[model samples]
Target chain A: MRPKTLFDKIWETHIVHEEAGKPTLLYIDLHLVHEVTSPQAFEGLREAKRKIRRTDKTFATMDHNVPTIDRNNIKDPISAQQIETLEKNCKEFGIELFDLASPYQGIVHVIGPEQGLTKPGSTIVCGDSHTSTHGAFGALAFGIGTSEVEHVMSTQCLWQNKPKTFEVQVNGKRPKGVTAKDIILSIIGEIGTAGATGYVIEYTGETIRNLSMEQRMTICNMSIEGGARAGMISPDEITLNYLRDKPRIKTLNNLDSLMDDWIKLASDEGALFDETLKLDATKIAPQVSWGTSPGMVTGINNKVPNPKNFEDPVKRKSIEDALAYMGLQADTSIEDIKIDTVFIGSCTNGRIEDLIAASKIIKGNKVSSKVKAIVVPGSQVVKYQAEKLGIDKIFKDAGFEWRESGCSMCLAMNPDKLSPGERAASTSNRNFEGRQGKGGRTHLVSPTMAAAAAINGRFTDVRSFDVDLGEY
Target chain B: MEKFQTVISRPAPLDSSNVDTDQIIPKQFLKRIERTGFGQFLFFDWRFNDDGSINEKFILNEKRFEDSEILLSQENFGCGSSREHAPWALRDYGFKVIISTSFADILFNNCFKNCILPIVITEEKLDYLFKSTLEFEDYQVKVDLENLILSDNKNFTEKLDIDPYRRKCLLEGLDDIALTLIHEDKITLYEKASIE
Candidate 1:
């Protein structure tokens, strides 16, 4: 018998039919939708007069354009209209919706896992790229375009070619202060933005197995940044434990039998992969991106790389342009770079654990007078949990604005955006040009590092802060 | 979807790499439910100043490139965000074809669905195209999709590579939903069996 990779097993099972020359009709288990990308997709359904084929498998939420500060009223007319459109579409289609007023309202990725909608061996997709976040549950998840969204909404399936599998193995324990975010950023930096193109990356290693479910989600969330179609970590005790208390899982009658199947979903021994890369996790350090792309990252202790060091003219030019736009000097230490704002939330790092980590650092310290810091939880549940733990108070007492849950300052679809030329230490995923705001400079960092920057008013090593993590 | 057979039009060069979708169309303009009418908002941040005046320095705003239908850009064009709006905005803004050294996966796939041909050319060939666009006042190149060839009248031609499946769909003006509907019976069976 041929040994099969995990991706092959799950993908092959989902195939309705595949001919010699046609694209595979892959059945999708879950379809997550948000405000920004679903409007046109629903409109496509309306134009064609097609009803949603399987509303039971589809879920809608309003996140991207929702303001984190104000829950009752959205001041921006455009933002309000997009949310309203999503509500009308979901109601019309008879799909489940977690609107702004709903307790489950949060980032789509966050709500999916918390609700146990993302399950092992399931194939999930959303119009937003962070759909990869669900892959942490051992699902084959990836992002799709609006047209593909409409197709899935109408048919509960997609036309896709099987992507080759790439294995990324990280061995050894990650050094203290180095997180899943840093590890992913370092991997992206080593392999440039397009390195994993045309592949689905399966992350395997002792280090990966040891990570918490939230940490694994953080790693998979940025897989798209590395250009992979998706990233997956095989489900284990950690995954099952996280799902045990989830609402959906609690409704299951045969939990033990389901767990048995999930455990067997791992790739067989001697499974074939198209490519493999191994890294020593002990060597990874807290990373920061100095350029517009997530791949332009280096260890926090390192100096900004000079463009002249690049042999490729295209790379050299990109580095030069990024430096000019970011107001960065070549060979200068990253620690010396001052930031005007610090954002510590997004689908990438807005989980309860992430907020707890940031709150530990900010417990007794005040945010620097030179900086304006804000923390937005990933979901309303996370916000509620933080309040129960008094983490919100820790942040607010530290001079950081403890805002409501949403993708605030990540893409700046709302009022919480950086002014032109303002620099931010962000915990969100992408740092593309004008991603946070028009002409804003973003240096991607981890939650702890973002909190450190808030207190120091500059990019500082989290290890340098002599803080105790008591009862965090 | 329009059938894309051939296109011969003036090409404008955007000499930048990693041109993400956010830059192509800012998130603020993505509020509209309709896919059309995105032309005015294409590159809104770069093409216009904060005071609502045109920024003359941007290449698209230059008089010579105003009517160009083809865009020649560097590698990794449309790198961020899975917005179909990126391609829609480009097509709505009058771009019939995009030639780049490479394209981000989602954007590349979205182009075929919208009938906007995204051709992948080598960096060396891209340099030649960029040079030609700048050297000539009204540079025009002929893209023959049937033959998978890009040719300039003056001593330049390059063979492009595209998936035969995508090429056929583009040429036939077939959308994915329509094609998938052909297997609706099989899909229905699979869904019913899985539920049971």
Candidate 2:
């Protein structure tokens, strides 16, 4: 037998049929849904009079439009109606829903791993670009359009041209205060926004193996930002440790046999990939995005890049436009750029460990008078765990508004948004123009960096801060 | 979905690279359940001012490009979130085809689902098209999907390539779900075998 990559192993196992002159028909093991993207898909099913093929495999949640501040009072009529529509669809189709009243309700991507639905060697699809987040467990997961979502709901299958495999090998130990968010952002900066257009990336090397599952998820969550539909890390003991205590895993039989299978899912030695790129993790610094695109980023101590540094006319134009939208001047120190808001929540960095890291920096300091900072956890489970650890109290004592969870201020579909012309230091994935709000400027940073910025009202380096995030 | 074979119309040139989906259709309009009526809000933030007035500096606001059925952009078009609403907005706004140097992976797949032909061209050819369209207000191009040819009246003709399966579905307006349901037996067998 030929040596096989992890992606090839998973892709080959999921194949149901491969007809000549057509795309392969692959079976999906999980289908995650949310309020914003599933409404139209259910409507498609209703119009066709088709029943959901596998209700047991589907999961639904309310996010994107739910209010993070006032959890019950949904003032926007359109958003309320959208939520009601999802409730109606889930009820009619007999699909499990994590409603607003349920303790499990949260961002679909966050809750999936929390409940152990995302597993090794399984194929996952959601009507969200961030579905790549589940690939952290070594799954072949990717995002889909509503049409494909409906197709999967009807037939439990998808037709796709197999994507080639790419390897991103990161070696060496990262410095203290640099985080998974910084590593992923630096990768995006090195490989522009369109770097891995037609390939699935498998992150490998000593650096990846040394990180926790939460850190691996943070890296996979933003894989879409680098233009890949999916990214994965080979399953190992870290993956097993994260899944052992999950509720779904606790219900399964023959745990040891399942573990053996998962361990075998790693790529074989001497397996070939279509392309390979290497990075030294030790060289990475705490990154901050300064422009509309994720690729327009620089280290914390550096200044905003000059558009003249780029010789391509089109590249220069993009940089100039991004600078104008961000209300920034060329060669200005990143730490000198003032911010009015600080947002520390998203599927990217909204887990309990992320909250703990941020709380460590904000324990004794107050948020700047000029900055309004909020910390919304990723899920109800994460929220409960943080409160149990007294992390929420630390944030509240430091003048931060500790709130509920639901992708708040990330895409700004809900009430938590930056006002027009407001500048925010955010922990979300994308920094595209108007992503936070119309005419709003967003600079993407990690949780610790966001907390430090909230304290100083500017882009401050977490490395220089006088706190120790011991053993995190 | 609509059947598309060929289109002869003016092309609206979005000269920017990495034109993300959030800008194509902002999140504010995504709350609506129905898919139609999105053309009115296409590029809402860029087309309209904060005070609800028209911004004449935007390219789509120009009178000559009012009825464009084709969109021409630089590399990495539709680079952000996987909202199929981006293609719906472009389709609703009378764009049947998009030409670019490259496209984001999810958005590229979503275009085929929405009956839009996404064509990839070389940098040199795209530069020619951008220059010609910017120079002439009434410039038009002919996109023949059946023969995989893109041509203008003057001095440019290039052969394009598309996946045969996607091209066939668009040319015939076939329903993807209905087509896949034909393999129900195989799917069921695979499910049963895996369970055992």
Candidate 3:
């Protein structure tokens, strides 16, 4: 049977061959690189005396170790070294790079989409898990390992097996104050983090269909957290409209014609799925991860689940472990959890819209003196846009450290780390144990709710602050 | 290094939902890329105490699963980042079978390449497997790859669902790189032709 869903079509097109006892070899359309993961891969290339086969097909950027403060004074030698290493590697490999001084330089994920390098019906890979973010544009994008990165560097091909396809149909319009983050967190809560495992989650239905490009990106970006290879929505007029007239590649134009092939990517109404999950957008609310892992989320008003309430012994034990690690009582309200830091940016939540939404909540209020909040833009471009609208000044005026663009406290790659035992309310994805730092707790919230957490020093509903979130 | 028929073992039923990759192999242990030694650190964040003692409540610390080589996790196993360390750690720890309702895509593909058998069962079947293990004294599942069949001698039995070619690869213990090399002569001919 011919494939109906975009995932199947992309998979079929990319499949070099299918043989007994072997995975498929996919021809990678684009290869994205960064500092932390590329050093070893580039080192391997140097050792093997191989040049990047096709530099035009590959692109590079630096983000992981970029400092969030005093951008000009990147005094730390290691930080400087990482950026330098990326530049040197890209130059040696004959690949295009967007370094600090380059107007195109930004978060690797953010750069591809912003420049239209990422597009529908293509296969993309990066050495970062959040590479799944590109799937938002109706591409099959996912992260690969260093060895795999080296393999792709040497040969623009990946040894990948096709993933089973799953459909997550989110029906109904979102209620007020609910956001894309809430829709995803609610899905995580329903399916659990590993729910979409071994599948390319093709997000469908009216709700996902209606989301802005940025929101669709956010939704697909978190597909990793749900254990999907990548999450995607079929490109439509919204996608074409978003890509039109952007400062993208010179060759790319007229997305209207492109839509002909793009529209064929969605699953047919009666297409078979390995698994199907349905969600009601209207029922979701502002979500927060009270415990470790994105699946530990609940509505803003919900209480921490008691382990004893779990039916199964294994689940009970797991919940107990989370409770012990978080140092929270089972029945305590999530609203009561105190926080010391508030971070509102990452590839998952660091777009200009996220900043604008966050600024709306904190425009008039002051963050708690005890809370040290920082708003790091996903890219330098996002920073420029936010600054153009005075969003950065508003954030700084409300006591947020409006710092430089890059993945900061989200993983604490640079010096921007939370001390031990510090609790933070963040807009970035992932709340794994010590993900922020050793013994540092993280509660995932939407950017607006993160702003609320900054003001209140605990998790709170964004509605309490009374800013119209505009769209759910 | 090692070749085998499809890896066949019983998933040591851990009936918890949303088993994250971080919980499978935490970020603390991700500092290194040497994939071999991660077995010791598998579930380090979830299985150990802050003081480095085993958290007795964790499944790994349970006596019932001391010799368990297969992991039957609940839905959404290996969610989070596409950390290849997860399957490496699971394989290094000697887990051959990871039967679950679902798994994260990247890690799922990574598993087959590393000789880990990732099987997806229906949720009802998963519930059956989880509960059946509790009742049987041996509760052992035997996967015979040659037959492409899995059965617990006492009650439960099912065929492991996989793509036909993937099934062949698992049975033959071949990976994508190995598969590509199979057509090297043809590729060489094509390359020479293109050059000409």
Candidate 4:
């Protein structure tokens, strides 16, 4: 038998049909939907008079436009209407929905993993790009458009070209302050934003194996930022451990047999990859983006890049434009950049471990008067866990607004947004121009980095902060 | 979806790389359920001032590019987010084709589904197109989907590549939903066998 990459094995298994020169019709095991993207998909189904073929496999949630603050009372008529439409559509289509009050309600990416719906070797599709987040569980997950979403809803299949596979191997022990967020941001910086275009990345080597499930999810969530179709870590004992206590896993009748199958989901030894890149994990610092794109990143100790240093005219112009939009000076120290707000949550870094890491820095400390900081947990379950450990109190005591779970200030679809021209140290992925809000400047950072920034009102090295991780 | 055979129209030059989905249609405008109205809100933050007046500094607001039907952008156009609204806005705003050095995977797929021909050209060609479109007033390029060619009618011409299945689907105005319906019986059979 030919040696196969993990992605190749999963891709071959899900294929329903294929011809010599046509895209394969791949079977989807899970279809996750959200309010913003699913409305049009449902409308397409309604227009066609088609029914959801497998409603049991589909899950719906109202996340993007839902208000993180004032959870029960949604004021904006447009947002309210979108949410209402989703609820109504899910009911009509007989698809299960995790509504605002539901315990499972959270960001579509966050809640899918929390409920154990994302499993090893499964194919997951959602309308949102962050659907790649589920690839952490060894699933061949990727984002699809609303039209494709409708196709999956009606046919339970997608016509997809098999993406080439790339391997990102990271070795050596990570430095204490450096995290999964830092590691991914570093990789993106090393390989420009479009480096992994037309490929799915299989993260391997010592560093990936050592990461906890939450940390792995954080890395996989940002794969899109690097232009990969998806990023996955092969399932192992660590993945099984994460799934064991999940609600969906507990209800399974054949857990022992399922575990055995999942353990075999790794790529075969000597499997071929189209391309390979190696990174020394110990060299990664607490990273931060100095420009609008995730690729325009530097370590916390580094200075903003001078566009003049770029040899390519196009690259130089992009850097100049990014600097102008971010209101950053070329060659200035990144630590000197002042921030008015600090956002400490998103699917990228909103899990309970992320909160615990942030709280470790924020405990017994106060946020700078000039900085407005907020902490949003990834899901209701994460929020409950944080609160149980008094992590929420730690943030509240440090003057950070501990809000309900949602994609708050991540893309700023909800009321939680930075005002125009406000500079923020954000833990979310993507620092695209005005992504957080119209004319809002976002500097992407890890949770610990964001916490340190909140305390200092500027980008600060988390390693230098007088905090003990053991206490948390 | 509309059937797309060929288009000959003036091209607008957006000389920026990594023009993400949020920038195409900011998250604020994504609340609308209907796809048709997004044209007005396309590049809302960039097109208009905070006071609701036109920002003439923006290239799309320029007089020469007013009625352009083709968009010539730099690498990685429509990079972030998987919003089909990005294409909806572009199509609504009267762009029949988008030519770029590269496109994010999902955006490239979404463009075909929405009948917007996304042409992946070489960097040299993209640079030539960007330069020509800026230098000449009312510069038009002809994109022939059936022939798989992009020509300026004068000197520059390039052969483009597209998946045969996608090309067939677009020429016939067929979407994935329509294509999938052809094998509804197979899908049903597979689903039933797995369940049992």
Candidate 5:
């Protein structure tokens, strides 16, 4: 029994009704679908003899399975079929689709914010779990399954029980070497993966407020790492400023009027939470996942976790397995781990601001000869804006492959895959074994970290390789 | 379109922990815009051979669990990724109850809406449940929607704790759309009032 937080307020506003033990039905404001998770939902509709109820609420894009460099080459038949089926499904269902050739095509999480489809105090769902990326806008968003996808498509509402509220306040400003990604990674490591289960996290405190939209996005994007349904930052002057002048966003409410309502998005001073955690960001350092799960994280400067330190046999065995799979010594420093691939994209860090940070790290520097690097803009609009600023040229000049945006190398559905046992430093969420490719090991890091890894051909700190930013 | 009750023989054993949505329904299959024919591709990579033949090594291919309609799994089953296809594939491939010691937050939430039951049982009970599967005969589990109970001829009976609201929706087969239509009268009145 907690006082109403922003999550409760937003969820209650959309509540149609509730059943006692059954789930309450919630009206979904936006439904984002990508090629990888939509086909089945569309197929379910066909089987049920129904069509998409609201075409406007639903949007489709191809990202997970589309290749980055081989735009013209159709090397993999399975990848081609998946993309083709998505096209067929979208066309037949009359849903808007952003195919590969279309400039609107990008990561679904990235595209929603750029298009203003993501609004303050809205519920968003996609087939991709990192849809938590939308929570940066102070929206309640999470990944849904195909059946729920069909449910959203047909009715624009979903069955859900309101989750308990949890507030994570990070006091003090972040240290220079620490990014939002590092802070979240440290938090996940502290809480473990299932710590925030059945909770909607409201992040606050001066540290969270000081973060840029890109940095807030990076923090909120990985809420799933600690198993949150969604993570939200209260819509403040920062949120209002970010939404100003967006196209369709202005159609609903202009920025001036919207700010008046948006400021009320914070949790009340006396609001209660099922749980509360206060983090001091000043002490956090750059972190990396030593094991398969993102929660198996540690300071970049620290040695690998020893099995002797673990109390749970399951977790210890998992660490042992992970260490064996990752081919690392228990006491070896994380900085010593070399990377074969460095990907800076996906919903987590694929934004204009992410590119700006990465470019500063790789402005005149070159990627290591042994490392294959890719920079994917989160959205088509982000791509265009970055191109206008010649961010694309800076990356290309630094020898990173400039590719059309998609969930490239985040999950190995696309041609951008790692060979078996290949190690990667990725900006996307998730670091499970074989996540990037079958038998491919991924190390989750921020985009700047990915750039640093690319330059050194090993896990390194971006701050160490920083070139001067022109100005504020 | 059909209304019938199915009495499942028993739950099958899947020892693998942290079974992800990617493993259940891969990203490759997600490209299809439609939802049908997913059953065939369910567990495609795990249960099928490279040549599209059945991989006898897979648990789903075992004859002992061939008729099983329920799955009993380890902690954090369905851990990674939020592909709805995982449940669609599970339901389409004829699974109803996914009894696990624990489940991922996102996956468990998706299960109820997809008409799949995600039951959380005690670890001690899970140990007993896994042993109970050793004897295939008379291990039958009866799930009666009318009674809202999960029981067997044996002394084992577990009452499901579905939210009463969800119970109504599930028992009545009312999805979100049906629930929304219940407020039609109020909506109409509000619309009329707005115009006036």
Candidate 6:
């Protein structure tokens, strides 16, 4: 047999059918659905008179448009309607739902792996773009649009073109204060957003292997931001340990056999990738995105770049437009850029580990009066765990609003949003114009950096803070 | 989904690269259940001033490009978010053909699901289209889906590269779910063999 990449191994195993001039049909093991993107998909299924092929394989949750402060009283009528529609659709289709009242309810990407529904050597698809988050467990997970969502619901399979493989190797030990978010951000900055447009990236080498599963999820969560189909890390002991006792997998009796099969999902030693890029992890600094796109980022220690430094006319123009939209001037130090809000939550960094890292920087400190800071947990279970550990008190004592989980202020589909012209240092994925709200400016940073910014009311490097930031 | 045929109309050139879906249909407008009526909100932030009035300088606002069915843009046309609302808004806004140097993988796939035909041309060819749209007052291009050719009748002609499966679906206005149901038995067998 030809030495197969990890992606090829999983893809070939899942193939159900193929034709000469058509996309290959691959069976999907999990189909995660959320409110904002699934209503129309359900409507399509109803109109077609199609029953869900496998209700057991499907899971629904309400996250994108739910209010983090008050889940019971949803003031936004449209958001209320969307949530209601999902509840009705899930009931009609016999799909299990982790509704607002359910203890498992959270962002679809966050809850999938946290509950162990996301398994290695399987394929996962979600209507939301952050579905790549589940790839941390070596699953060939990727985001699909709503139409494809309907297809997966009806057939438990999807017609997909084979994606080429790209290996991104980050060797050497990461420096203190640098996180998986920083490493991924630096990689995006180096490779323009479209660098891996048609390929799936495998994050390899020493630095990736050394990170925890939660940290790996943060790295894979933003692969879509870099325009890749999906991003993954091969399974190892850390992966096995994380899934060992998860609620969904604990009931299954054949775990030791599963672990043996999961470990072999890693690519063979001599497997060849279509393309490869290497980054020195030791030299990376904590990163912050200063422009509309995630790729337009810089190290926290650096100043905003001038457009003239870029030779490409289009690149230069984009920088100029980003600076104008962000209400920033070239050559200004990043630490001097003031912020009005600090958002520390999303599928990207809303895990329990992220909150612990942020709280370590926030304990015994006061949030700046000029900034309104909020921390949203990724799942209800995460919120329970954080509160049990008293991490919630650490944040609340620092004047940060500790709220329920559900992508709060990330995309701002709910009432939690930035007013016009208000700037936020966010731990979310994209910094696109109006991603948080209309006329709102966003700067992407890690949770610790966002916590430090909350205390300083400006974009400050985490390493410069006097607090002892623990290991991520 | 609507069938794709030949479209002959003036091209609206949006000379921007990495024009994300958030910019195409901002997040505020995504709550609506039906895919229709998004045309009004297409490029809402860019087409209108903050005070709720139209910005006359935007390309789509120009009288010359009114009712344009072909949209010409630069590299990486739809880059962010897996929202199909981007293509729904574009098709609802009367764009049947979109030509760019490159496009994001997910958006490129979503375009096929809608009636929109996303075409990829060389950078040099795209520059010529952009220049023609900017210089000529009555510039029009005819996109022939059946023949896989694009021409402006005056300047140049170029071939289109599209997947045969995608092209067939667009030309026939076929529903993907109905087509995939043909392999229902194979899907059931695969499910039985796999362990969850």
RMSD of every candidate to native, in Å, equals: 1.4, 0.9, 4.9, 1.3, 3.5, 1.1
Instruction: Indicate the docking level reached by candidate 3.
Output: acceptable
True contacts kept of 4: 0.80
* lDDT by residue for model 1 (A1-472), tens: 8887779889988999898776788999999999998898999899889989989999989988888877788998988889899999999999999998898899999999999899999999999888989989899999999999999988899989788899999999887788899999998998778888888999999999898999999999999898889999988888899999999987899889899989888888899899999989999989999999999999999999999889998889999999998989999999999999999999999999999999888888999999999999999999999999999999999999988889889999988998889999999999988999988999999999999999999999998877754322
- Backbone N/Cα/C clashes per model: 0, 0, 12, 0, 28, 0
lDDT of 5 by residue, A1-472 (tens): 5556888778877775565655677777789887666666677677678777678878888888777777657677877887888888888988888788887778887778777788888888887778887888888998877667777887777768778888999998676657888889988898777778788888889999888777888888889878888898878778877777566677773466666777887677788888999999888877878788888888778888888789976677778878887877898888898989888888888888888888888888999999989888876788898999999999999898888777778887777877878888988788876677766788888777788889999888655754653320
- What ordering of candidates by TM-score runs from best to worst? 2, 6, 4, 1, 5, 3
Please provide TM-scores computed only on chain A for all of the candidate models, following their numbering: 0.98, 0.99, 0.96, 0.99, 0.95, 0.99
Q: Which candidate's lDDT is highest?
A: 2
Lowest summed lDDT across 10 adjacent residues in model 3 chain B is found at: B1-10
- Highest DockQ model number: 2
**Candidate 6 deviant stretches above 4 angstroms:** A466-468
DockQ rank, highest first? 2, 6, 4, 1, 5, 3
My TM-score estimates for the predictions, one after another, are 0.98, 0.99, 0.82, 0.98, 0.89, 0.99
Writing each residue's lDDT as its tens digit, candidate 2 over A40-144 gives 899999999999999999999998998988889999999999999999999999999999999988888899999999999999999999999999999999999
Candidate number 2, chain A TM-score = 0.99
Q: Which lDDT value does model 2 have at B141?
A: 98
> How high is the CA lDDT of each candidate model?
0.90, 0.92, 0.79, 0.91, 0.78, 0.91
Q: Model 4, DockQ value? A: 0.83
DockQ (Cα-based) per candidate? 0.78, 0.89, 0.26, 0.83, 0.43, 0.86
lDDT of 6 by residue, B55-154 (tens): 9989889988888999998888899889988989998999999999889999999999998999999998888888888788778899998998899967
lDDT digits (tens) for residues A1-472 of candidate 6: 7887789889999999998999999999999999888888999888878889889999999999999998999998998999999999999999999999999999888999999999999999998778889999999999899999999999999999999999999999888899999999999998889998999999999999999999999999999887899999999999999999999898888888989999999988989999999999999999999999999999998999999899988889899999999999999999999999999999999999999999999988999999999999999999999999999999999999999999879899988898889999999999988889998999999999999999999988898867665558
Model 1: lDDT to the true structure:
0.90
For residue B155, give model 6's deviation from the true position in Å: 2.2
